[model samples]
Target: MATKPEGTQATRETEAELARFFARYEPAIMKLGQALRAKLRQRLAGLFEIVYLYERQGSLVLTYSPTERGFEGLCSLALEADGVKLHFGRGAELAKADPGKLLQGRGKTVRHVELRSVADYERPEIEALLVAALQLGNVRPEAGAKGATILKAEEQKQRAARRPTAARTTAARTTAARGAKKAKKARS
Candidate 1:
């Protein structure tokens, strides 16, 4: 049998991780997220590195950066329950020329637009905004850079607390402990 190419295992693992992450969402939401990711990859093909980030807020974010592990991201696609959002990292810098007023945010730098459908990706104004943000961020893909890389997954402590399964587990443990103490008293 032909040996697998180097890094193939890692790639498969990343894909599996991403799939598992997406599986947490509803089917409709997952479909929208996948479409949004595909559109972004197609638009920025060969021009930037797509970094997958499992954020602390339970978001699976795809960040476009000039370099792998870069300090700043040019833009990002955040998967959400209703749909996906495109976030411009240097939105504050582009606000002055934002004729469309499509970006929504009051923060110092970041701005975002909710993309509810695939048609949103084809808008000229959105394309312009993305290009502007990329320019302002000074993001240029390095030679021989891979098209995408999935960063190591991050697990948030807050998420565990909010999980129903975790709550059930805690309740079960407490009940078991109480039952054990009652049985010991009866034996005594």
Candidate 2:
């Protein structure tokens, strides 16, 4: 993938948002995720990227599509705490294309291959799967069109605040009562 010009505001924001997303995972997983994403960008140069950061689930997903909707994605990269997965959106259609049964998942629509490193993406079988997926999506990479990224959603895990103990609550009330008494006395 060509390096995006650093001066562009959109590019800077996208990089920063992605950086924050990667910060949630372990170093090794984060590194693998970055490498996998770079390889995907290189392989699918002109496809629009729709990103979803589900921090509550500890997963970050990037879907490459001909259009903006993720449901229209040709393929997706799912980065979780454990590792990364390359998901073929139309895996059911590509089952015959993958005679080796490399793709996992029994769902009717999607199937994925667990990716350990960037090199896994370069494997012949995976490359073939990608090409087949593109064809299935009926998308051809537009010449000289480096796709833009759209951050669809970010769901950060919400931490509940600790409730005050009964003793603390009582003490607080007592303090407030004493202050009120002192104020009344002063006014009198």
Candidate 3:
């Protein structure tokens, strides 16, 4: 009889582990998504969004028309079952925005539900996020700072945007920016 190497076996085991993790959370995850659907629909009624989910890469992002308050969009909730990593920026900002309004909790995760016209999101928005959190129950979100890279990219973009356009060429004066990330990680 032949046996697989420990490394290969470990990979398979890890895959199985992730599969098991997802299986256990699927029910709760689906239920949470459904409960928030109405609120999400109401808030994101007419907008563009992109949702990506994977054992490693997971995100639910929404981009919409800027409201009077100048909020460009929301990061919403990003979760990974394997790591139980959940980010709570959308709700944190909302909470800070309006007193006695936004939900209070940083370690806990909350998804964005509605847009706020006032300087801060209304109490209802916070309540909605809290509802989502309760539905999610006590799950510790993984804490890791992945935003620094994004900030660097945005800072570079802003710096480029601020530079004066060339005088001679009309194209140079135009302010069209394209997202650029070197296709090959090693750009030699």
Candidate 4:
């Protein structure tokens, strides 16, 4: 029997895993994820190499690193809880000079900006922050590194997940009731 090559099987598994992960989010979130991904890839093009890592906690991270295996990351785009965030690995240290005060978190070395809308990507301060972070990390584009790269893609064992919060559930129910009422009135 001819066995399929290992790389082919791995690629298929990764695709399926990504598909499954994406299916769990709302359409709006998926659209936002696509936009953020494109924006970041464009902004960092020809710079650090991009790597997508899917976590067991149901978060997808796009990490930018100088070397394939080296010290901490320069920056990363994370998709979580129906939103996208841009994380600066050494954010805490940069907080002192952050005029925009957009970076959040109290971690020793990490800071992040939660992007509520696509417009966040256009803020001048964001680009400034990214540049500062790259400089701080001492990251320089490789001689011929011109684009993003996917170094690893995989999913972990599934676990029981929590349901949406009560407020969201109530809002959904109210919307459905209003929709049903509108349909009945139209029929009358």
Candidate 5:
């Protein structure tokens, strides 16, 4: 029977490599995740992408970006084994960090982040994922059909619907207050 994959990156045939990586690092790696989180303290917010850096049994460890703030995802990578994991920064921070640029200029351990723009996504490396998102409508829909007009119309309709009820409520409250005042005057 085919087994579930270990934590290594998967393009297609790397499943076996993943299994090997898991076999090499499994139980110890889980503890590594705990250690990483402890190091980050609670900065482990959930805003950024989490990345795991891998080396040969702690040879060259590097983290690029993580989805969760702090080291949450990084710890997950550590816990999983398939490879080494250390917490990187948030996704935006990672991108802005220009690990690739740093590596290029200074021969940093991290190197060459793959920058995929809307145009660059047409490349083979990303085409499949792009197609999947397209299928899922993850990208914005076309103009006109789901454009700003629809949103503006909905907002206008909501405002128009609210106005009459708000006016009626205000009028009712005023009338009730006036009636109460008249009764008090009569009593006086």
Candidate 6:
């Protein structure tokens, strides 16, 4: 039997942790997230992959940085219920880099592109944006160095509260009103 490499077990554990984190999302969304992550790992070769699992928000954020600190992340893949977003950490500062105006966000520093699939990330424009994001962040990954996945937080299984739909909101109000009327009649 061929012995596994030293880091093979750790890599498997990391993948398993990510699999658990992605279980709540739709299959398409999960696939997109994985694709994006694979692409990032390939492109940002020596950068550290910092994973943040937000159980309450029902999201998994994978950030790439030269160091382990998340704040130094050049880019991130934010996986949520609706879709996957490619976030440029210093987007606002990369004004000249985004000639196509592909980025969308009103924030001061961050901007993102909603990725429908890996093809979106492979676009020349998006590739340029990724380069710009890294340049702006001043990340210099050592040539041929392998990056490792760093799980920033332990898994928290708390489910996020879904937004109440209009019908649900109306039904809840009606139910509350009926309860209030019943209490008033009982008091009388």
Every model's TM-score: 0.69, 0.77, 0.32, 0.64, 0.21, 0.76
Instruction: State the lDDT of candidate 4 residue by residue for 75-188, as single tens digits.
Output: 887777668888888999878657999999988888999887788877888878887887787765544335534444421222213234666789999999999999999999
- Candidate 1 lDDT, tens digit per residue, 1-188? 11112268866766676678778778887888888877776666544434444444557777776655434777888886666888888888878657888889999888998888888877888888877876786655444434755453443334645788888989999999999999999999
RMSD for each of the candidates: 8.5, 10.5, 18.6, 13.8, 22.9, 8.0
Clashing pairs in 2: none
Assess candidate 6 and give its lDDT.
0.81
lDDT (CA) for every model shown?
0.70, 0.83, 0.35, 0.67, 0.34, 0.81
Evaluated with TM-score, which candidate comes out highest?
2
Query: Largest lDDT belongs to which candidate?
Result: 2
Considering only N, C-alpha and C atoms within 3 Å, which residue pairs clash in candidate 4? none
Give a tens-digit lDDT track for model 6, residues 46-151.
8888888886687899989887778889989999998999888898887678888888998999999899988989999998988887777777666666787887
lDDT of 4: 0.67
Candidate 3: lDDT of 36? 44
Clashes of 2: 0
Q: Is candidate 1 or candidate 2 better by lDDT?
A: 2
What would you estimate as the lDDT of candidate 5? 0.34
Q: Summarize candidate 2's per-residue lDDT along 8-31 as a digit string, tens digits.
A: 887888789788888888998899
Q: What does candidate 3's lDDT look like per residue over 86-140, in tens digits?
A: 2333555445444544344544434333332221233454545544443333322
Clashing pairs in 1: none
In order of lDDT, best first, we have 2, 6, 1, 4, 3, 5
Error of 5 at 175 (Å): 0.2
Model 3 lDDT, residue 151, Cα: 12
Q: Report the CA-based lDDT of candidate 2 relative to the real structure.
A: 0.83
Better of 4 and 5 by lDDT: 4
Ranking by TM-score: 2, 6, 1, 4, 3, 5
